[model samples]
Target: MGLNLRAAILHNVTDNDQGQLQDTIVDAISSGEEKMLPGLGVLFEIIWQNSSEADKKEMLETLEQGLKR
Candidate 1:
């Protein structure tokens, strides 16, 4: 069940069958739409809640770098 949930969540990030939604998300994030940061926060919360410590640390570093921009 958890695995399925994880897949579903990540599919939004990884799916490429359609381009617009993913492109929009990327553009919004790159443009620093402050509202979109919370979406990233929610995604991070999901990962942090379920991932191993090493994975969480890796993601934390990535997110920290992104937030620094």
Candidate 2:
């Protein structure tokens, strides 16, 4: 089977603590590298999959507000 980018990225960070996860996200954003986007998208997908309706709503609202700025 071909290498799965999403699975690879998720597995790479699966054991991370909250602080480590935050650092990974911050580093990815601060570096402003397009290559980092897939990893971030994977992380977001995980979050979206596990989130409750209210949590998803809040996230959407936050994203919408950020985009409007």
Most lDDT-accurate candidate: 2
Worst 10 residues of 2 by lDDT: 1-10
Residue by residue across 10-60, what tens digits does model 2's lDDT show?
A: 899999999999999999999999999999999999999999999999999
* lDDT of model 1, residue 43: 61
Best by TM-score: 2
Each prediction's RMSD over C-alphas, in Å, is 7.0, 1.0
lDDT of every predicted structure (CA atoms):
0.69, 0.97
- Write model 1 residue lDDT over 11-37, tens digit each, in one string: 766554447655756777798978677
TM-score of each: 0.45, 0.94
- Which regions of candidate 1 deviate over 4 angstroms? 1-25, 61-69
